[model samples]
Target: MKNTVCLIAAASFLCSCGGITERPIGVIYTNAADPIAATASGGSRTGTAEATSYLGLVAVGDSSIEAAKKNGGITSVSSVDTHRKNILGVVTTYTTTVKGN
Candidate 1:
């Protein structure tokens, strides 16, 4: 019974992110930058914002389009993209990128 409990906990911890289906999440590491939006015209400027999580307990940072635009000094948003990196389900970082003039 103890062994079964441990296995369940391990499985839950391994798949804690629940984003494995969205993208192939590697148990050891996951680093991907994917485009979430399509654009008609390319942007002249770009900005990025980031958010991070520690052991799915403490999460910090602002990964928002508005924040990205603010940081990049972009007025109009032409396209939006996201970059995600996770390590052993312990540390996770999410970044939002905005492109515009």
Candidate 2:
């Protein structure tokens, strides 16, 4: 029973809720952007769609490529990027950026 209890506790603390490929560096704050896609065309226009999460409970927003394109008036997509920010896991925001002409 003691071993089982210890295992459960360890499991709970070891589990994480994230899609990051590598270990996260920021426990208190994190704001970074990563390139996702690229094309041959030179992008002259830019648009961004964002989403936010509160205490990992309520998440709202449209962080989609289509939304970004619509917001930027972009007909041809040349590049795509993703931006993420987390403040002590209490408030988190994600943004999808699309660039096109």
| Candidate 1 lDDT by residue in tens digits, 1-95 | 99999998888767745654776667788898899886797789989999999998999999999999999999878999999899986999999
TM-score of each: 0.77, 0.78
**RMSD (CA, Å), each prediction:** 3.2, 3.3
In order, the Cα lDDT scores of the candidates are 0.88, 0.88
**1-101 per-residue lDDT for model 2 (tens digits):** 99999999776555553334463535568888888999888888999999999998999999999999999999999999998899988999999999999
Clashing pairs in 1: none
Q: Which ten residues in a row have the lowest lDDT in candidate 1?
A: 16-25
In model 2, state the lDDT of residue 11. Answer: 69
Per-residue error for 58 in candidate 1, Å, reads 0.4
